[model samples]
Each structure stands twice: as structure tokens, then as C-alpha cells.
Target chain A: MRHTLRETWTGLRRNLTMTIAVIVTMWVSLSLFGAALLANQQVDLVKGKWYDKIEVSVFLCVPNVEGGQCTSGDGATQAQKDNIRKVLEANPQVQEVYYESKHEAYEEYQRVYRDSPVKDVLTESTIQDSFRVKLSDPQQYLGVVEQAKSLPGVQAVLDLHPVLDPLFMWLNALKWGTLGMSVLLLVAAALQIGNTIRMAAFSRRRELGIMRLVGASNAYILTPFLLESLVAGLIGGLLASGTLALGVYFIIIRKAATSITTIMWIGWHQAFLAMAAVLVVSILLSVLPAFAATRRYLKV
Target chain B: MITFDNVTKIYEGQAKPALRGVNVDIDKGEFVFLVGQSGSGKSTFIRLILREYRPTKGIIYVAGKDLSTLHSWKVPALRRQIGTVFQDFRLLPGKTVYENVAFALQVIGRPTREIKKVVPETLDLVGLSGKGKRMPDELSGGEQQRVAVARAFVNRPKILIADEPTGNLDPATSVGIMKLLDRINRTGTTVIMATHDSTIVDQMRRRVIELDAGAVVRDQREGVYGTA
Candidate 1:
């Protein structure tokens, strides 16, 4: 074992430039993999936060108004409003119900749009009252929307899904894009590792011939090359995971988390999982190629 | 210690065989020379004994193991019983003389203490006791070949195969190497050397087997390099 380690060190040092190339390639590939994992986790975090907070807004008519949605052409009466609330509350999927009156709607609009000129034109008479229903399973909003559409006072049953779907869709595409790029880089990294080991073995063919002549076993001859590749992969993976963790801490936690406090950010638990994944991938990338190349090229 | 029985070796895609119907035997503690010109199948004979290549026909027995039937994994154990030296003195240039000699023992899993004890002794046997720290390039051609010999004999192999061991040395250096091989042979190790060095062959007065066109043309006891 001591000799194997010593030989591995000598082999690595003998080809310092190739060793550095393998390590740097491995690092870039593994870090990309780690970044993809973290991005997916972040996407899932945002999806869960935003999806749970989504409310199906059921708008009612305005009273004593022309061209209103109700049959009376004024607005929905207090009786119709109570009936709609009863229907929403009785549904098994509705987790919570919030009723916003016309006056309250106008106030919220004015406060939220205070910086916009549209706030000057909005009034209590123009604003519509609504029932905000939170579902037990946010994905099952179709059932609630269908039930609310038949109610007497409902002007229109609006679901927040369409507004948020496109945003989440783009985020999911970004996550997969990174993951796809990482797969390509992983292949490049595997080939790079195989080439490096092959070169190491080729350069030492003379020594290998002597070792074989002196009764060295195939494993004895191949171990040093295998160890060199494994060591390079391990170091690269460690650096990649470290960089990933630092990137998450600095970019996600420090910057994104503060700017988007309403969305939940992935934590250390996800980072650890990403690191483990990167480590396993890096091991396979290094060991499989090194093992196969030694078997093929280092016939001794 | 070594026997070849009607062995014939024909490489792939070749019309001519490298060796044909050859039979020879060397007893334990005997020194034999395989003298031939280039392409005379001397290397093929040595390779057959080492099990580097299996004979196309017939069988070879070394230390009572059949070469034709030896498992590939067991090849190393077979080679462990026989030490081989090349004309090029194939030593790792990055290692010092001590490391080069100790490597033979290291590869065979000898303990460090045993290696430390035996390597210097083997170097002394090759007349290189104090030169263990020198690198291969720093040494003369004769000294490099001595290091190779030391590495070969460090394991105390029963058979030592030297294929043109002094092919690259001058006449004087070649004679010095021949004397070293003679001294090693006197210690009861069977030495099988393949060389075309007529002067070394004549002076050694050892058993010589001459080959021509992939066939043994003559076998003479206490022979010179010329035809019997």
C-alpha cells in the first residue's frame, strides 16, 4: 500500500499539467452538477411557497350599478353573497375563506398601487367585492372554480394558476437547462479523466515492463494509476461541493433570499444532498474510466 | 529446471513460424547460452519459457508447471520464479539505484525491513554497494546493467533469463558483465543468456545452444560461439 501510494504520487507529479487539467475539468463538471441540483431545489422551494399561498378569487357584482353582472343589473345582494360563501365553506377542498368587501378592496388597491397613477381613478363603487378561497390541495383548484361558477352572485371565478403557471414554467425550464448542460460536461469530464489516465499509463510503459518482469501482479501495476485518478477526482469533487455551498450561501441566501423574502429558499439540508450527489458522480466518473483504461491500456 | 517439448510458435498473419519443433532441457544450477543471429528465435524461446506467449503447438514445463495450461492470473507467479533482464536495462529513470533494486522486492510484497536488508546485499553482489543513491542516467552503461542484474537477482529467482544483457556495452564493459553473470551462475542459479557476443561466448566455456532459421542447429557442451 505504501509503495502504491508513493508510485501514485510520483505518477501524478510526473504529469503535473495533465493532472491539473483533469482536476480542473472534474471541478467544473461537478460544480455544474451541484449548481443544477441547487437550482432544482430552489425551484421546488419557490413552487411550494407560491403554490400554497395561491388563492382562487371569486368576484361578486357591484350593487346599484348599471351593467353589473347580477340579474338585477345593480349588483349581488347580501343574500347572494352569503349563499356563495356557504357554498365555498362547505367544499371539502377549501382550507380557508376570506371575504373582502368593496370598500376593503378599494382600500387595498389604493395602498398596493399607491405609486401608480391608476390609483387616482379607482373608487369603492368601481371596485368589486370577492371571496378568496384557499384550497387543501392547491392543484385541485378546478373543482372549486367549477363550483363557484354556478353561484348566484359570482361575477367571475378567477384562479391565480394562469398568472403563476408561466413563471414557474420558465423556472422549471431553467432548472432542466442547467441539468442538461451538466450531463454534457460530465461526459467531457469522463473522457478527460480516461485520457489523462491513458497518458499516464503510456508514459510509464517502460517501468511497467520492468515491474511485470519482476513478478508484479496486474493489480499491483494498475493500482497506482487508479489511485492517481481517484485522488484527482476526490479533490475536484470536494472543491466543487465547497464552491456550491459558498455559491448558495452568498448568492441565494445573502442576495436572493433578501430580495424575495416572501419565497422560501433552500437551506443547508439541500446543499448537503447536492454535495453527496456530486461526490458520487465524481467517483464514478473517475473510477470507471481509470479502471477500464488500465484494463485495456496497461496490459501489464 | 526448464524443458521445451516439440514447441512451435507461429504468430498471427505470418507465413513463417518463429520457432519450429524445438526441444531442449536445462537442469537445475546449470548455465546455458542461446547463441543466434537476429530473428533466429532466441527471443521467442525466452518468451516461451517466461510464458509471455504460448506455443502454437506442443508444451513447455518450467519448475514443473505446463506453460500451455497456466492460468493468465498465475502468469505473475510463474514469472516470479524467473527473473529477466533486457538489452535496454529497463529501469525506472525517476528512481535511484536503491529504489530500482528494491522495487523488485516491493512489487512482490516484501516487507520494507527485508527489502532494506536484501537490496544492499544484492547491489554488493553486483559490485554496486555504495552506488545505490545514483540515478540511472548518472551511471555508466555497465553500472546501469549492473543495477538491472541486481534488481533481477534480488528476489533470488531460480532462473535468470538475460536477453542480450551486454548488447549495448563496449567490449570491456561487456566482459565485465559476462564475468558478473558467470559469478551469479556459480552461486547455483540457472542462467539462460541469449547473446551473439562471440568473444564472451568463447571465454565463458559454458553450454551453448545455437539456433538458425528458427531451429536449433547445434547443441555443444563447453562450446565456443562458432558451429560445433
Candidate 2:
């Protein structure tokens, strides 16, 4: 162990530029994964913050129907509308339902487009009434949806769960994509490490040969070099984690959070842990290359 | 003690063997020079001892281990008993002379205190005592070769394999390196050196194994470097 360390320290000292290059490469690889992690975390934070207030919009039918959603009992009958109102008011999941009559609907449409020319093309006679439902929480929509589907008077039900659905879906894709990119960068770092070790071993071929002749074990020959690689990788991981944490804290959390204070704040502890995880991963990936390069290219 | 019994080596895609029916015995504490021109079996002999290349048709024994069956796992163990120095020196360009010598001990997982004593002492033996911190490039060819020699002998190996130790040095420097090898031999370590340097061979008057076309044609005590 003492021998291995002395060798590792001396190897590191001798190969300064190569050591720096390895560290930089590892840092960049880890940082890419870290950024993607932050992005996914942000998306998760947004979804968690907003999912509690998911709403459902239930459109009501006209007295004599004209928007072409009236075929095959498709539009709500009077009985169906009455049943929906009862369900919304009594269901444990429902917080409240504000019924929009045709008049109220027309007024909202006008209010929304008061300055637009499109408002002149529509009147209250042509507008449809609807029930605007807000749930106690978004997750309750599953139970509420099952009940709403069987209700009579509802013409259509639109749950706000679909809004947060895209958030999770996109987050999933981004996390995996970032993971793939990190793997590619890790491969690049390994190859670079291999090349550097090869050159190093090649240059010291005589020393290695001599050592072998003297009955020095292979373990003695490779241990120091392996340790050298581990040291380089660890240092690189630390640098990468540091850089990523700083970027997340300043760029994503503090600066972006300033404009999005209504959303959520990412704490320092979680960020620190994430970077630490990245460091561990980078260090693990580097060991094999150190072994392979020395064994194959630098073999005496 | 080592023996090469009718050993032959055929590399892939080569029609002819690198070594053919080569047979010889090198006893313990003996100093022998393997002499041949380039492309002769000089390198093949050294490699066989190191187990870098195994014999194709015969058994070669080093320290009682049949090298033909030596596995990768057993390699390091085998290497610990023999020290080899190559013609090119093969010094780590980034390392100082001290570190270069220390690396030999370090790789085997030696203790720090042991390496501390061993490294500097080895350097001093090679006449680089005060030049320990200088990098490989900072040293001359003779000094670099000496470092390689010191590394080979640091473990107190049973055998020292020097394949053209003075290949890159001047005549005087070559004499200095040869004398160093002689001193090492006097300490009871068997030495096997491969060289084409006729001047050194003639001067040493040691046992010389002359190779021609991958086969030994002459083995003599107090022999001169014979023609290929």
C-alpha cells in the first residue's frame, strides 16, 4: 500500500499536463449530466407545486343545440346536466363548481376579446354554457374522472391533470437524454486516459522490463498506475461537481428563481448531494481504462 | 538457474520462427552476453526469460517455473525475481531520476519507509545520488541507462536481463555501464546481456553466447563476441 501510494504520487507529479487534461475531461462529462439533472428537478418542482390545484372544465349543452356536438345523444340532456351539478357539489374530491350560463359565457368571451375584431362575429345566442370545476387536489382527478364519465348532463369533461402530464413526460425524456450524453463523455474520458497511460508506460518500458526481470510481481507494476488514474478521476469529479453546483446555484436557482419566485426554490443541500453523486460516478468510470491501457499498451 | 530446451517462437503471419531449436543453460551467479546482429535471436532470448513471448515447441524454465504455462495472474510474481533493462532506457519522461528509480519498488506495493531508503540508495549506487530530482530529459544517455540499471537491481533480483544497455551511449559511457553490470554480477546476481557492441564484448572477456539465424552457434567462457 505504501509503495502504491508513493508511485501514485510520483506518477501524478510527473504527468502534470496529462493529469490536468484528465481532470478537465471528467469535469465536463459530469457537468453535462448535472445540468440535465437540474433541469429535470426544476420540471419536477413545477409539477409538484401546481398539481394540487388541477381543475376540470365541463361544457353544458344548449337548450336546442347548434354547435354540431348534438348527434347520437352526444350533447347533454337536461337530466344529464342536472346529474352533473349534483355530482360536482357532493363528491369529496370537488372543492367547488361555478356554473357559467350562456350569458355569463358570452360576457367572459367578450371580456377576453374586448379589443379584438373577432368579438363582433359572436353573440350570446351562439355561446355555450359550462361548469368550471376546481378540485381539492390534482391527484383526486382520478376518482373524480371515473365519476364524471358516468354523469348524465355533462357534454365534455377536461381535466387539468393533462397540463402537468406534459411536465413529467418532458422531464423524463430530458433526464434520459442527459444521461446518455454523460455516458458518451465518460467514454471519451476513458479513451483519453488510456492514451495517456499508454504513452507513459511506453516511455518507461525499460524500467518495467527491468522490474519484471527482477521478479517484481505484476501487482507491484500496475498498482501505482491504477492509483494514479483513481486520483485523477476523483479530482476531476470534484471539479465538475463544484462547477455544476455553482452554475445551478447562481444561474438556475438564484437568477431564474428571482423571476419565478411564485414557483419554488431549490435548496442547497439537495444540490450538494446531486453533485456529490456525480463525483462518485465519474471516479468509478475511470478505473477500468487505467488498468486496460497499462496492461495492453504499456506491457513490457 | 535457467534453461532453454529446443525453444522456437513463431509470431503470427511470419513464415519463419524467430527462434529455432535454440538450446542453452545459464547457471546461477553467471554473467553471459548474447551477441548477434539485428534480426538475430538476441531479443527473443531476453523475451523468453521475461516470459513476454513463450516458446512454441519447447520448455523454458526460470527459477523452477515452466514459463510456457505461466498465466497472466502469475506474471507479476514471475517478474519479481528477474530484472530486465532495455536498449532504449524507457524512462518516464515526466519523472525525475529519483521517482524513476523509486517506481520499481513502488509498483510492487512496497512500504513508504522501505521505498524511502531503497530509492535513494539505489540511485547512489548508479552514481546519480545528488541528481535524484532531475527529470529524464535533464539527464544524459549514460545517466538514464544507469537509472534503468539501478531500477533493475533495486529488488535484489536473482537475474538481471540487459538487452543492449549501452546501445545509445558513447564508447566510454558504454565501458562505465559495463563496469556497473560487472559490479552487480559480483554481488551474486546472474546477468544476461544481449548486445552487438564488439568493443565492450572484446574488452569484458566474459562468457558469450553468439547467435546466428535464431540458433546458438557458440557458447564459451571468457569468449569474445563472435561474428554473426
Using lDDT as the measure, the top candidate is: 1
Tens digits of per-residue lDDT for model 1, A96-204? 8888887887877664444344667868887888888899988788999999988877788878576767767776787788778778877877787778877877777
DockQ of each: 0.56, 0.30
Sorted into a CAPRI-style docking class, model 2 comes out as acceptable
lDDT of predicted model 1: 0.86
- C-alpha lDDT (0 to 100) for residue B212 of candidate 2: 82
Query: lDDT tens string, model 1, B70-130?
Result: 9988999999999888899998998999999998988889999999999999999999989
Clashing pairs in 1: none
Look at candidate 1 and tell me the lDDT of residue A257. 66
The DockQ of predicted model 2 stands at 0.30
lDDT (Cα, tens digit) per residue for candidate 2, span A97-117: 777777887876665444334
